[model samples]
Target: MTQPRAVYIHVPFCAHRCGYCDFTLIAGRDDLAGAYLDALQAEIERSPLTEPLDTLFLGGGTPTQLDEPHLQRLLDLLRSAFRFSPDIEFNVEANPDGLTDAKLDALANAGVKRLSLGVQSFDDRFLSVLERRHSSESAIEAFGRCRSRFPDVSLDLIFAVPGQTLADWQHDLQTAIALQPNQVSTYGLTFEKGTTFWTRREKGQLDQADDSLERSMYGAAMDQLAAAGFEHYEISSFARPGFRCRHNQVYWNGGEYLGFGPGAASFDGGVRWQNHRSTTTWIRKVLAGEDAIGDREQLDPEASAREHLILGLRQIEGLNVAAFETQTGFALEPLGGEALSRLQDQSLLELTDDTLRLTREGRFFYDTVAADLV
Candidate 1:
């Protein structure tokens, strides 16, 4: 197998946890910042890098939440651990509130070339409901500042808010486009278990948008972004030509990557492992010179084949059936027979001579289609 070319570093600190977020993150506890960086460095040092990383992603809770010194220390450690490729795409996820000029400078100096800002929505009401700390204005300012430093910038937006109208969602899309970001990701709201939104919905305090309305909101996003000259490369991601997120593409394409930090996931040499989700436990284990991984799975051929099918379908361009078979040593026809037939009957999928891709309607219920195949 060739050396893995992607690296993912998870920084699991947040000023406050969002009501709907389920990603592994801790609220408050700024004191642990140094220790966390130290632990992260230790983990990176212990792991081997077989090649200069072509892509590196610093995702979070919010990577920008770390103070300048901590951020620098973390970056310094990464620089020491791996030789970054000359054309490497180093992406860091930032929340608007944490995107100070100093932090942005630190990121640039650390060789970060891309920024993914969590702009959630341009509407203050929706932002408040989502427990987002940054105002839309602040997000705009942050992106403006980032543009001066990073070559590529992406904004994340969520549609299908409870009580959100089509016009409101359209306005959000327009607002993001106005920012002129290199890329934008529009997502529908999902109520994950254990989230405040999930509990509220269970108590009848919150209601999800109707399925039809949500679909319309997604459609509006696609129409608007496509009009703005962004390529809808992935289902949720729209990018300018040549500005697609290479690190993310690695995951969607089933390429190998190494992840570090609490709740970070890694797949390399056909093995998948996830670090412990608890910050305290992760720090303690790493400090004790122990592997912080909690669960490890070596995917069997069939499971790996299934994962490729599921992940590949997420891309708007889909996957080549022949290439999929070669990767997994299993034919796609037999594995996806019933599911593919049903989706095709519904006019949700189209199979050309060698490729399979989603139609517009299929993209909307992609999860359902993917589940049937799995």
Candidate 2:
């Protein structure tokens, strides 16, 4: 088995939970920060990696939300846990609110090369609807601060709010592009099951944007961002030249990675597993010298092949035919040619001399194409 060269550490502490979020996170849980770090250290010690990591990502709840001392400790711990390649892409996720200047300084001094700021929107109204704690002014200010510190910074934007118009969504995109971020990710709001938004939507108290409007908003993002020199690298991600997110690309390209902390999933040796979703439970189990894993999945060869194809198509570069065969030991045609042929006829997929990728129309209907392939 090949050694994993990518790592993801989830910090599950947040000041407040958003109504639309269903991620594993504990709100108002600073008290557990110490114990969480202790458990995280112990987890790393238990299965230390032998290979130098090429990329390390600190994701969250909100990693930057940690107090200065705790945040420093977490960064130091991670830095020491692995032997990193000198060019490692060290990235961290942060929220705009409560990310003080001191905290930003701490991040810069810690060798973090990239920052993914959760600005969500530059519109105060949408921010309120999304239950974000930051105002539009503050988010822009925070982006400037982040840009000053990191060579590469990514902005997150959301569109298609219940009452949001196409013009409003375009304004948000314009605002983000004006900030000159190294990368941008745009997503349409979705009401996931078990979230407050979901319950409200079910009870008819909260309305979702119509499908056509949502599609238009997504289309606008692609057009506007592309015109501004951002490469539409993936369905939801864009990057300037030389600024693609390496950590996420690891997953999309089906490479192995190590994950730690609550609800963090690791893919290694063709088996994937996730730590306990509850932060407290993960801490207790690790402290008690027991396993913290709460779930595991071992994909069969056929299932794995399908997944590889699906994830590869998510990227605009699509799948290089020879490379896919070499890596998966499965010819593309036998595995998915019939389905690809059918999609090609509909102009939803394109099969070139040595690559297979989603066509412009196919990207919008990716779920349908993936369903057929699966």
Candidate 3:
């Protein structure tokens, strides 16, 4: 009777796909909305319910893209699946264009207490370049509306876009600060394969910022956000006190969660499963009384320990050396001795009270450091 502490629902519908997004999403599939909800409900019902969920996250394509009735139906399915904690942090991700009053009302009634808005940039030009449908004005208006409804609001921003100067990045940060969101997640643009930007780059239609410039932008964001009283809790996430994303923490801390919907990923105990990415395939399987899972992997102890190291390093709080040993039965020093020694000698890591964490400079070269450990 193992009950999940967190639940994640993937809503794969979006009005239009952003050029830079590589997430599993379907564009112009609003026609599949009804069937998708039904399948999701069926999937949840089939899942074993053993615990009250502490956190529930509705991440997307755009959860707000669903109509009122569909959204309500999904929420109802969740409520039926497991009992929610009295103080559960229910989070929903919304694009600016979809954050209408009606959607907000539906979310509020559904008990969603946190809103994570996708506001990639405050500059209109950058917005256009990023293929975001919302204008800067609309994003600001949406944030204000969300603030009036949800107790906790997080704003997502992207920095280090091609041709973006340091001043431009700083301006975006300053604008986001003025909005006074409860949390801010700043990420650098990665040219993910299969994304429009990746193809464009290959064809010389788009350029990526140089490493030095990207590093500068990252440093600037860290300094600015910290000065604004946001905790650099994770590599790309910053939050005010008591506002760190609890659902996300579950994943980073190696806890179990159940994911539902097309292209969703789930981890329970030591088994990991991913659903089919195609909306049609997912709906067909679920309607046929079969799970939509396309792949399943049962992690061995060594693989799981390596994952713990990788994910834990993403958090600024770093990994507890002793806990890592207990969880995987593999001592951190033995598994990553050479890399750890090199990093420590370079002053990129600090060991205090059986915990190993990155220094400020270490965070900048995190990819290199993480590779060494692997």
Candidate 4:
């Protein structure tokens, strides 16, 4: 197997947990930040990278939630622990509320090349509905700060909120485009099983956007972002030329990457594993020199092929048939079976001699398409 050239470090601290979030994170856990860093350093020390990494991602509940000193320590620890390619794409996820100037300076000085700001909406109404602490003005200010500090920045936007109209989503898109970010990621809101949103939805306290409205909102994003000269490179991602997010592309391409910290996941040599979700539990295990893994799965050839295809189709460029067969050692036709033909027949998929990609219609129904194939 080839050596992995990417790494992901999860920082599971946040000031407040959004009602819709189900990610592995603890709100009001800043007290544990120091120990978490210590455990993270130990985790990296145990399995140091053999080669300089091409890309690294610091993601979390909110990485910037740490104070300047702790944030600096986290950055310095990662830099000292691993060698980095001079042109490495180092990214950090940040929320608008607590992104202090000191934290921004620490990230910039530490060679963070990209910032993925969680600016869910520019509308204060939607922002409050989403339980985000930052206002539209504050988010815009944070974006300005990020732009000054990083060469490339990405804005994350969520649409199809319970009361969001198409015009409201369009306004948010326009707000993001006005900032001229290097990239943008747009996602429709989802009520995951364990999130507060789900319970509220079940109780009829919260209503989700209906299918037609959701579809229209998604279509508007595709049209508006594209018109603004952003390439719709992936289903939910738009990038200006030459600014695609390298770290996330690694995942979509099914490349191996090492992950550390609680709830972090790693994929290598056809095997995948995740660290424990509970931050305290993970810190304790790593400090005690025990494995922090919570789950592990080894995929056989067929399973791996299925996974590769699923991940590959996420990108607008789709899967290259010849390369998929060569890499997975399984023919796409046989692996995809009748479902492939059915999707094509439904005009939800497009298949040619060399590539297979989702149709514009399919992009909106991606979950359904994945379900059929999976």
lDDT of 3 by residue, 280-336 (tens): 999999999986899899998878888878788889999899988888899888888
Between which residue pairs do clashes occur in model 4? none
The segments of candidate 2 whose C-alpha lies over 4 angstroms from its true place after superposition are none
Write down the lDDT that model 3 would get. Answer: 0.90
Candidate 4 segments exceeding 4 Å error = none
lDDT (CA) for every model shown?
A: 0.90, 0.91, 0.90, 0.93
Task: Assess the local accuracy of residue 317 in candidate 3 as a C-alpha lDDT between 0 and 100.
Answer: 92
Report the lDDT of model 2 for residue 138: 97
**Worst ten in a row by lDDT for model 2:** 332-341
TM-score for model 3? 0.97
Q: Which ten residues in a row have the lowest lDDT in candidate 1?
A: 41-50
Error of 2 at 162 (Å): 1.3
Better of 3 and 4 by lDDT: 4
Query: By TM-score, how accurate is candidate 1?
Result: 0.98
What are the clashing pairs of model 2? none
Candidate 1 Cα RMSD after full superposition onto the native fold (Å):
1.1
Off by over 4 Å in 1: none
1 or 4, which is superior by lDDT? 4
Candidate 1 lDDT, tens digit per residue, 250-283?
9999999989999999998479999999998999
TM-score of each: 0.98, 0.98, 0.97, 0.99
- What local lDDT score does residue 317 receive in model 4, on the 0 to 100 scale? 83
